[model samples]
Target: MRARNFVSVIAAVGAGVALVSGCGQGGASGSSGDSKVIKIGTLHPMTGSNAGDGAQLQHGAELAVKKINDAGGIKALGGAKLELDAGDTKGTPDTGQSEAQRLVSDGAVALVGSYQSAVSANIAAVAERNKVPFVMDISGDDAILSHGYRYSFRLQPQNSRFGATAAQYIKDITKSKGRPVTKIAYLHEATAFGTGVYTAFKSEAQKLGLAMGPEITYDAASVSDLTTQIAKVKASGANILVVSGYYRDGVLAAKAVQTVKPKLDAVIGAADGAFDQPQFPTDAGSAANGYFDVNYHLNDKSAEAKAFADLYQAAYHDKARASAGFAYDSVRIIAAALERAGSKDPGKIRDAIAKTDLNPLSLSNGPVTFDEKGENTAGLPVLTQIQDGAPSVVYPDNLAAKTIVYPAPVQ
Candidate 1:
């Protein structure tokens, strides 16, 4: 029941206090009566374009399971060991659905991950039908929780929250720089994740009375070059460009800026997508230097969050990813739920997850609590700029790693 991790929740792991209240030793699962093992399935992309992200998320869950088992597993379940049942989504919806079935068939009482919004939706459906408890690590599309399912819970903020937060960040950034962001341009992928963020942001922009310009939506998969889309952004004469998409598309968008070379003050983002991933700087080179992305990130200022960032970076041999922490926390949360429920029955696990309220050791955010819709009520997003190649937290004042670099010199 230790609350620790970063995107799939991202950060390094460090020292933290013992977590969660446990029910005295009891049988966690009917199957565990003999094997004394509680299985949790980790569903995420292990192949395809988002494979790198999936791999990171998978490792996060692996580390959590290791940490839990190393500490004597679930004490309430007669010290039953936690077993991770890993499944590959292959970064596709159909594959994701199939994988969920595979995991459930293998006797997983709980599940975590599958990063894409679309894929997560598919897995969520399977988990719901099978009556398995699902903890979604990272898939921000708002509709995931709108279906009124009782079994699935999200550990991150909804996509709509990202839009409103980004709009407010834009206003603050412009005001600090003494140049008001008047006209705004919108660019996003056509997928649910992309379109959902943009739709919410557009509504927020309208409320702010900002003049809207060209809004371009394109497929992130086939659209390698964004000249056709950037052309519209350029012609719109907007000082700010708000983009939504994943890493590959974000790189294309940044390159498009180089190709079209718009005289833009800033190109902010709704999703970490391209900017927050480690490969972004290496992929985009100098172009990623000035780009700022707004997404959920670790508030490393807290001792617990700092501990997690260190642990994740050291264990993975790479800096913590934007989504790693949540994934890690999700697994731990499920494990804690198992301890609280004292039963492996899916319904009991789901009930325990609903009452979870431990402070996450992964990020310096709010306590881990769920609303009626199965969304984390404490989830908060962060703004980051690619400062010298790595994402540096720079917003919300209290958790900032560095100050915002207004008008980052065009590379």
Candidate 2:
């Protein structure tokens, strides 16, 4: 049976236990009643290499729950408060799946999480099997949604979208600056996350009549040094170097580029994790300057986004990253689903989520809407460049926060 409808079959069997146990009453351990509180699960790597990003995702969801509750909770459900049951995946697929199962068993009607694509895939399966709605906050690999699971949804553009957009942005910006396109070197982590992006980027770059070569790969978890990789890129005679990888490895690649001094026209990132991060400049030091990344980012021009960012900063004492914005939106989407469903039943919530049509605070092409595959067709990514020690949107003219700086100055 379809996961969305499958929940109905089990709802009856579970209702008695739910009522007797008062699920999610006391932090999902046991509480007052389902009418008083609705529980949602947040899965992320809380104590691993990606812990930094995971914490932001959790914080964003927390802030959204607080915002909704402060505004009087879900009125349709008689002011029922939303509770978050956070689970740490430790950046592993096994742990992610286990945690997802635990959260649903505890009482989460809907779930959001797992920054890494692989981890998200595992959690997606758990959600599907348990007949709970799974909303992705930031996992980008397109294959995650290729399965015909109706219970899973995504708020971010797929990796292929990020790659193609990056290629187009590079072509436009370079040509506009009178530099035009030339040879490009690609470096990415050897994982579904990085490889998925590189594959699409190379195809799109080729389609745009841009030359690509010197593709390099490294293990994000074990690789500490990228000097050898950067040296290959420098020798490739490529004028543009495109990188795709996670934060720590991305920072390592930046430092390698600095040490190697490739003298490329521009060192850019295609769906790169570190290039668009708030802490990248501080972590990569001088190596971070002039780097560009084509990926999803917060719409700084949106008044709502501005307000949200301010609140996030005041609460966390740190600038909100794009990943956090998605997390916040995920929670809001769940709340909207809860309000619309008017019931804590997982089946009803899943159906309501499938019909979501709401404006998102993130930089999107249009109001959030999901296709049959649960991909947010309205989702879009923007190009950002680290200028003046901070990343700023620099492309798409409409969302440009700063003008393009082409052929980056030599360090």
Candidate 3:
């Protein structure tokens, strides 16, 4: 039987406790050119806490698969069409493992996903044990790549890189424009992703001689109000505010800023996917204005990135922010490896991935190359400011499509 024909049980990602199922659909439609199908699994938080992030990643992967198939499928595998065998991790480690087995049993040669850092770690372990190539989309925790797992690879800049980038970007902005950003406050969720970024940011900030104001941590999903956190940050006389959290946190943070009207000069987020969400500006209203999200993202100025953004916006009615772009690139990276290997063997695919050197023109970070640690060396963070109700690249001059809104007018 063709690998694509194998259908496995899909978790009821939304409900979390139900045993639901579906067929392997590459968004599944019959294409005349390729009779053979290559199934790629996306194990992500399709439901539960990080559901929004999971759905965005899933759509990005789907879009990539569709684009490949539309372009006459993979020529190396007898014009084999790509198929998606997605599993929802439901925001849990146990479900991530079970779903990993399900994806492999259902015939996935390679896997991509589980956006949450904790879930991604478990998925990475399963992929390693089974010897399947795993392409990561968006989990920034540093430990995910420290395991020495050969089968696991990441496309996004890891935690250390992200934190360092934030510090450097702040320094650069201050140096160039003389922006007074001496003391900064960090308010984040208490997750591996949040704390890891905070740790890295703190280290880098100290190295750059920046003062840390109040370091406030909260639960991204459970926390209802950040009023106290924002008040404390304000009281610390922090001119700059850094936040790390998910969608709800982003909204709450922005609302708190609006309510408290802190004498803040700037508010930056550390790849807190929520700020990149379409609903962020709407939910946060004018408060989202001038907020910058510093994380690895597609180079908006690149023609190729712009084109993909258009496609993604059309499909999802939302911007192809970093998370979506990360997902698309993860799938495309696997596809590129498959093409290079010119075979269906998982081992061959793994080798191709290890040797990957994607041209900067193809991705935002420019030159997608994985180091010995399975981290994309060229994957660096970009600075994006919420401008005119949408997020636009503002710093790292080359990748930025728009200029920074200095002295953020958060009126």
Candidate 4:
């Protein structure tokens, strides 16, 4: 059997286990005019609290794989076709490490996942040990890069950048209105992503002369009522609210604040709100409106972004979120690097990806260049708002869909 056929057979035998173990198990057979088949593995939380996030990312990666393959496979590899193998990490750090190790052992040349930061931290060590490149799609904690893993590369900006952007936006926009920035409350989940952004935003807010208030941490898994915390923020008379966490916690936080009817000047979020998932607006009600966030895309109307968005909707019948953009950009970046490298050698691929700079595939809100620490130097993000029911870019003026709406209407 040809390698591709053998791999397919393995996959068919054990969809769950084979996904991680199918690496080089298949016989590399099939003739498509000097085309070598390259394998890339995906490790994501296929089941767990973050299952929805992982599944969405999986589809995004799949779409990218299909588009790349259809574009004549890597021409630099003499028309080599890229192959995708996926593993279920179950959204745990241990599982991420195990899945990454399995992919490397199975002969996968590169990896593309571990959507959560805690999980990505585990996967990075395994990829480093095996000399395989792990191109991250969503994980944005600064600690992921601080570890100094040479074999890892991040396609998305870090949580720190998002926090910094939030602080700066408040400073620039608030100052323009001649309003004295008073109290700022930072809210976060107990998760690593949340904690990291909390720290980043606190420091940035302080540096920008914004007074900081008590930090509010919530339980990510089960926090039904955050009324107490929201009341505290309201009592503090904070003018600014900086929230950090994924959709679930963000939704709850927003709703909690609305229930308490806080008189706040501005409400901003980090990558946690990058995707304006329906649940946020639905659950949070009018409190969600005018909620600003630092996210991947600057606006929905950029020619490049609009094209991708239309294609995404046509293909999936749903709107593309921040993770989708991260996935697409990661795939394109890896494809370009692999093509430039000209071989499936892991070390070579790592070097090529590390050297990625100002890539055209990079978004307009920022450039795409990897620092020595494996973090993207162009981490600039755009501020967006949940206006009415959709996310609209509202900062970095040229790309904004609407003017800044501060002192959001009280519910």
Candidate 5:
């Protein structure tokens, strides 16, 4: 009887140990069958105001997984195929945190996603707590990387960089067009994403001798009209109007500008979401013409990028946007890290990502590399303009697809 009791106690302890081990390393490195697949979690707002953008992000990651699996999967791990575990945040921070937790509990070795800055912040905290590596696909708030968290990596240029680049582009383009910037009206959404870009733009514009005023803000989720705000911009007598906001709100602002007819020398976007979108021209109608967005986009000149775009279009029957490119690259980055790590341990994967050095399929200042803060040191944004119903690069002569038309002709 004593021997049987001892045996039962030992069995219980072993079971508990197994349970703990399973939770720590996830299922990717488990049983022989499980080790044949790696699970990667992706969080995005698939059912909220930003659903369209979220869908693109998810699809990009999906396409990347397909490409890798088709090419014989991860070579280091015996060609283990990648399995994406997608979660919907519904554009809320709480949902994002919860979804991240669920994904980790379900055995995701790494994570990617979340377009909104606020949502990404919450997801980042979760990643740090769980010691999981998170590669942000589109979130741009600089503060997200300021937390000193080693597990969170951002693929997009910080908001501050985006703002400064936009300002510099504005200065160079206006001067070359013989319509040097003077007074500028600024409009942005009321959030870290929008406000962060605006603050940096204001500082850069000041240094460039560009007077700015009539700064306006709107609730991106609630605001329905921007006419009164744009009317204020027109009354300020500002020669240029600079906008910072997401896709839905961006389109609304564009229509409002068309209605108000501010007659400004130029209307440009500082990391504006809607302007660089493939459907922006059609969605904004004639208002999209002459609209310029200084933001990150796919490198159309790269043959690899061209092939990816073709694959995306052929698979989805729509052109892949800048957001999609980032998401696709995020997956590729993870796969590369997995190959280097030769293990499915989250910590090992995180370390491998820190040393990443691969040429991206998107526009960038250099190859993909992460800094001490997990920020992509080589991320870059370029100026894109809407001409004849399509978005084309038009600045920084090296990447320009078309000559810019400044002081845009009256519609």
Candidate 6:
């Protein structure tokens, strides 16, 4: 039986290589025996508020599955190719619950995403009920792991850690220069991700002995203008601004800050809404420079980072975004768990996933090992500051690419 399995594995690998090499193979063909296909489900917002980033994440995950299948899939699973069953979450929690149920009912061995925290929270029950391992690629709600869901796994760093990273970076920079520590204002959307960051920053600031400014909350959806919110933040006489929301609000906040020209010591935030992507820099102008923020992985040129970067660029024809790395790594982590289990059973897969210790650069916030609560113990969020057009890590010395650059308030 072992000999027969070895032969099947070799045959599958050869077929996969041939297909990748552009030989006369249309696509991956299954062997005529047990372990036919490894079906996984992805619940992502193909359309809705967070669609821009969510769509990119979905594509990255799809690309990872394609590459895995092209490389002969899982040899231990009798050369079964990875197959993805994706559901459009519509970026809402209500839709997310229905989609999760549908995917589990359809017999998916594992589940991948629901980028928004609201969506993830709504679908988490379904995944738990079916014992399906839900790998979160984007949602960063603190309650995600705090609830102690055994089957839930998150590849991204927690929201609270990210908030702390950003806040600490500012605190360190100010202390080093002996600047007056006046006030810190926190801005957050009324979403789970936003609220998590808001709470963490407030707590960390108080611990650091920084004055906590009036915390401001905004509606993520339908908040076209942020004049009032910005005015309130400026009135607080805060030296630092921590915006904990999505990209749309980030743009609005940047514009509003420029118009008000408040005396801010620093402007930073958690990674959720802060990358200088597309036209953010062009739109924000000088405000884009020296903007401090935090993200899950660094876009370094190290070997591991390069390997994933090259493959991602080759497959997608663009630089991988923050969420893309999470999606790709989430699939890879799930794949490793499946390989270890040697079975499609969700219970075993969940156990294996909790034991994974990957060093993939695509998920460099830290090690991939998860504790019983499904939170990664090996990782902590990194602080970054926008220089030129990209975000480079500046905190956690080992992973950092450059020294921390404090944002000098425009005189």
- Give the alpha-carbon lDDT of every model: 0.78, 0.84, 0.77, 0.72, 0.85, 0.71
Arrange candidates by lDDT, highest first: which order?
5, 2, 1, 3, 4, 6
- Tens digits of lDDT, candidate 1, 286-375: 888878888877655668667767777675667667577778889889989989998889999999999998777434356989999999
User: Candidate 3's error at 192, in angstroms?
Assistant: 1.0
Model 4 misplaced regions, further than 4 Å: 1-35, 274-284, 298-301, 358-362, 365-367
State residue 165's C-alpha deviation in candidate 4, in Å: 2.3
Query: TM-scores of all models?
Result: 0.88, 0.91, 0.88, 0.86, 0.91, 0.86
Please give, for residues 1-411, the per-residue lDDT of candidate 5 as tens digits.
001121232243232111111111223334334778788988887776787788788778877877787788899999988877778888889999998998898888899989999999999999999999999999999999998999999999989998988888988988888887768899999889999999999999889988887789999878888999999998998889999998888999989999998878888999999998888988889988888999998888899899988876765666788898899999999999999999999999999999999888888889999999998999888999998799999988998999999887325
- Encode model 3's per-residue lDDT on 43-79: one tens digit a residue: 8777676676776777677667777877777888877
User: How would you encode candidate 6's per-residue C-alpha lDDT over 120-147 as one tens digit per residue?
Assistant: 9877878988899999888888887777
Identify the candidate with maximal lDDT.
Answer: 5
Cand. 6 TM to true fold: 0.86
TM-score of decoy 3: 0.88
What 10-residue stretch in candidate 4 is worst by lDDT? Answer: 15-24
What tens-digit string does per-residue lDDT give for candidate 4 at 275-352? Answer: 355345666777788787876663355576567666656655556666766776777778888988988888999999
Clashes of each: 39, 3, 4, 5, 0, 1
The root-mean-square deviation over C-alpha atoms between each candidate and the true structure, in angstroms, is 6.4, 7.7, 6.2, 5.8, 10.3, 7.3
Per-residue error for 124 in candidate 6, Å, reads: 1.5
Worst 10 residues of 6 by lDDT: 18-27
Local lDDT at 171 for model 2: 88
lDDT comparing candidate 3 with the true structure: 0.77
- Distance from true position, residue 244, model 4, in Å? 0.3
